[model samples]
Target: MEKFTTLTGVAAPLPIVNVDTDMIIPKQFLKTIKRTGLGTSLFYEQRYHEDGSENPDFVLNQPAYRDAKILVAGDNFGCGSSREHAPWALKDFGITCVISTSFADIFYNNCFKNGILPIIVSAEELEKLLDDASRGANATLTVDLERQEIKGPDGGTIRFDIDPFRKHCLINGLDDIGLTMQKAEAIAGFEGRMGEARPWV
Candidate 1:
């Protein structure tokens, strides 16, 4: 996972609620375990129409939001099914942070693991961010992981809360495997000691 220290980029506005994992990547796109190519298929059903043509109405299809690094969505974001791929697709699509009034617990946890920051805030604050995001190409937002703050395009700042341990992991680009690797020397020493003590086995 890439480190997420500070990110400043255009924010896409997605006001719809209950954006589930399947809506994000769709069931057909789940064949690959790899995370790299999933971005193209992110929001497959919503981004493309029945004939596979691009949907002009979707926020992501708009030129201003095509490269958006943040997403300001409605309440109950990421509300269904537990698929890690949701965050993978979001990251691949260039979204580093997601701001919403609320998020499903599992999806919120998965975001950190995949190097995506899922921010929970009040409904009024979310609306402010969403409006700021609707400012076309100027819908830029700044996210400071170390400070746990989000600066809207209007220059207003919003504070968010994250677990300190998770914050450390994201700041240093440490995933579960990365965390284990942090104790490599100790693990190796313990294994060697075990082998020496049970050499007959």
Candidate 2:
């Protein structure tokens, strides 16, 4: 996982509520365990038509939002199955941060694990961010993890709260595997001692 200290980029407005995992990457794209390549398929159904042509109406397919690094979505985002692939798809698509009024518990946890920042804000705050995101190519927003603040295009700021431990993990680029590696020396020492004691067996 990459370290996430601060990020400033265009934000895409996705005002639809109750976005689920299937709606994100779709079941057809779930066979691969690898995280890469899913970005093109992110929101596959909404981003493509029946003939596999690009859908011009989807927010992600629009000219201004094609490269958006942040997403400002409606309430109840990520509200279905506990698929970790959802966050993987989002991160693969260059969206490292997601701001919404509410999110499903499992999806929210998955975001942090995958180096994606999932922010929860008041309904009023979401409206403001959405308004900023509606500005086409000028929808830039800066997310500073250290300060727990979100700076909008017009120089407005919104403060958010996150668990200290999660913040530490993201700042250091420590995933579950990375966390285990931190104890490698101790683990090796214990293994050596066990090997000596079991030599007779």
Against the true structure, whose lDDT is highest?
A: 2
Model 2: colliding residue pairs: none
Q: For each candidate, what TM-score against the reference?
A: 0.97, 0.98
> Candidate 1 clash total?
0
lDDT of model 2 at position 199:
75
lDDT of 1 by residue, 1-201 (tens): 789999999999999898888888888887889989999999999999999999999999999889999999888888888988899999999898999988999999999999999988898888899889989999999999999999987789999998999999999999999999999999999989989999986
Query: CA lDDT, every prediction?
Result: 0.91, 0.95
Runs off by more than 4 Å, candidate 2? none
Q: What is the Cα-based lDDT of residue 133 in candidate 2? A: 100
Predict model 1's lDDT versus the native. Answer: 0.91
